[model samples]
Target: MSSPASGHPSPPRRGPRIAAISATIALFVAMIGIATSTQASAAPGCKVDYSTSNWGGGGFTGSVKITNVGDAITGGWTLRFAFPGSQTISQGWSATWAQSGTGVTATSMSWNGNLGAGASVDIGFNGTYSGTNASPTSFSLNNVTCTGQPGTTTTTTTTTTTTTPGGPGPGNRVDNPYVGAKVYVNPDWSAKAAAESGGSRISNQPTAVWLDRIAAINGTTSARGLVAHLDEAVRQAAGSTLTIQLVIYNLPGRDCSALASNGELGATEIDRYKTEYIDPIAAILGRSAYANLRIVTVVEIDSLPNLITNVSPRPTSTPNCDVMKANGNYVTGVGYALAKLGAVANVYNYIDIGHHGWLGWDDNFGPTAELLYTAANASGSTKANVHGFIANTANYGATTEPYFKVGDTVGGQPIREKAKWIDYNKYVDELSYAQAFRQRAVQAGFDSGVGMLIDTSRNGWGGTARPTGPGPTTSPDAYVDGGRIDRRIHLGNWCNQKGAGLGARPTAAPASGIDAYVWVKPPGESDGASKEIPNEEGKGFDRMCDPTYTGNARNGNSMSGALPDAPLSGAWFSAQFQELMKNAYPAL
Candidate 1:
């Protein structure tokens, strides 16, 4: 397989580069071996490096360097460090840190850093510490260096005194198993309602119409069309069952913008959703088809201000618009509705993770989690209100993934994890971010002994090549340095493409870290305009269906504008479905 492509605009240019006065200090710090402790000696085969300079404020800085110190640089590497009970990272660089009591483990960022011979790099961290700065006791690289000393070994110990925060609180919670699973069958409620009301097309040309159409038709025969897929997936896995993650994306007033249609569901509309949409689907699952299934429903609280104003059929009275702001509390009401539904059915709920370039650093996962949790909790729902969170539904293609790799590391050393948080490199190109997120989710206490899933629908064939900057003509697939054209037909236009095969499957359960890997979106669905078009594409339905008819006209042909409608022919859809079955479960 290869790296996925990115679909985000280029990052702003940096001002003239200023020479880091810290370079010499950084190098000198690298050589001194810093204050190493017994943790350094615990893993003899993996060389360890550390730093103790306080990066000002309450933040202290540290660095670690690991070398193979073994025969050869083998597979992947994992660097583990332990903080004293009194310390916690205020901010981290180069790598994502997971703390279990005093133990902190940093995994290699997504970008592959080959450690040949004695090649080494430095990964950094910033945190608040109290009491003694205990040196890390053990370092182990996956499938690479084990424990044993190199030709010659030297150890240094440094004890820096700093005030500490409250001791760690239960570490990260166990991850919810429903983190990532692809189980929706394109339930485009709006489109279906329009059709039922004798309208040829959905109002505002909504995207949910098409999704609902697909679900309505498929659900009848296949019990949401997901149960069979899950059964097949489980059968293929030798009866090792995995949860199927689904996205309940048909929220009224979905995208509140001129470019996108609204899915505004007022009290009556909400009731309709519960009765007409949610109830039937729950009933379908309640039957034998989904007896063993684990399901999560994401309200997909998209851009708040946009949805508030643009969404139709809104509440009878306008509520506070500020509440709709990103990470705002407007979702509390929605969570209440969803929680009510959860009372009758087994479902885990999540909010959106936003597309790659959409929010600031702090606005991404951390704040999103807090906001969703607050909303769910405020709705008077217990932990049962939500399962977890999800990243970009469609906007984040290949390019966006690498941009997120800015602060990842390998072997206790910093390396470009990727460029964007949800760039194509991790999704389409490499599966690194998917793996990394699973680990981070575990660290964040979201992993509940169940795994997470990544959406890889149109990303089959590893998406468009990486771009060469920002331009319309640039290759969409280009996002990272080493991504390749995936021959695996997970889903998409090339589902039946001859050379495709089933990609890797999750090796462990969520309790162990990652749970399952499944495509959240169906492939071959249009991206609103030309699949090649950029900018004009709206979120969710806008990305999947071309309301303005831009895509069909540009392609010099018109296709069906209904839910579950494929850009290709029925034969093509069948071929892709069959290919997915073959690759996902070859024996079946």
Candidate 2:
């Protein structure tokens, strides 16, 4: 979690002003070099000056300066180099390199080698580069440096090691690969279910459902007890050494914009969140039964629109559109709350990335990163407090046809600029923007390894197809793919639906830069609504059936709204829970 070195060179500036200035200088320099040169034989060989530095997150940046030392000549040549560290080169370009522990070797691409004599070329490498940047005692061309020849240019490699004073050591685990699941207590019905079915009935309910039921069962006592039971259930369902993703969704004013009745959380309301919601959850997690749990706090629930706008300075007439913007101080507030609850130790706080439509190009890249950085630091949380940014909790995956452009009747058409506000085309389609933001974070000393957990829960049939373009390709619409959105992978409820029985599990090995594919949201359960209307208001099946139902038909009916009359049926609830385990973690 340490920051990058201070004296590192700034990244090359892009866009109009900078590009124009660079062009002018390049033209003038070319003219002078051409005038001063006469014969091609007098052209000097290329000179390479290289340097590297570590940034502590298994990442590093390296710069290579290639200068033409001979008489004026046109064309490029390759520059070769090596790395002496223990890090995997996650990404690289303009040059190719391979790594083996403390030894890394690289050769420049064909195009990079074509440089005019007396002219200079600068190239950079950014990715998972590690170790000290001490000057390599020896370097060679093909195998040997130029010697015994006048005007003979030799490859000169210089290494400057820069170490940032303070940062987290390698021992600290700060990343969460799992997509989180909802967990909260429903006082009224949970108590009723617990009383009617006994402990067995209570244990059979889904995690959030059971917790709510327990709260109602014996008031605070049931609340405390439910935590233990939930832990046991998860352990049994996901293996003893399992890493589970638990989402704490009791934020006072969750999704205030979507539902006016939800109300917003003011100063006093935040205090209550710490007491009633955060404290109890922390206590439950603190219990010995759940000792192996790794928690991640995903700020806000259901995309609270304009959350950021409320606190950020804005004109009275112009409201900020981003929720996190309004609540610019929420990250600090949550950090303070977590510190007080003694829960920060086990939690990796992640602020939502919101849907592609919400954030624009520049704002998404620069300002968002600054906000996250400020929030973490102000909250008394270091880089260690955060794992990385996450994208789309319960939303669509990447697709080809621009979803934002598809109107009611029109399928494919050039989108108007006005619609650009909500158009995801400007944001989602640009992978370089995401990369630039991540690179900026790296430059600012934050970990560049980002994670995007697509909501694969209900996006199966409705998912967008893959995207294809120039630079690194990412899904234009959110969907599960093997490309690295850093440690790329998909976390959902079920996998390979057509394969083995209902409970069959899938593999976790990374495909396409993705490290693991996991099931964060347990399948076979309702998405908190009837099947007909996925978002309809209802207490879900747990509220209607016996707290112990363990059949698929009942669970499926409840999820699909086929069993509206039997919301808390025990048999129905048990069936859904059992089916989830069967489908999500069959190995367990």
List residue ranges in candidate 2 displaced over 4 A.
1-226, 237-240, 260-267, 302-305, 308-329, 337-346, 399-445, 448-452, 462-588
Give the TM-scores of the predictions, in the order they appear.
0.48, 0.45
Off by over 4 Å in 1: 1-88, 92-124, 127-242, 257-268, 283-289, 296-330, 333-351, 363-365, 399-452, 460-514, 529-588
Q: How good is model 1 by TM-score?
A: 0.48
Q: Per-prediction RMSD in angstroms?
A: 13.1, 16.8
Q: For model 2, what is the alpha-carbon lDDT of residue 178?
A: 37
Model 2 residue 543 CA deviation (Å) reads 24
Evaluate model 2: give its lDDT. Answer: 0.34
**What do the candidate models score in CA lDDT, each in turn?**
0.36, 0.34
Total backbone clashes of candidate 1, pairs 3 or more residues apart or in separate chains: 79
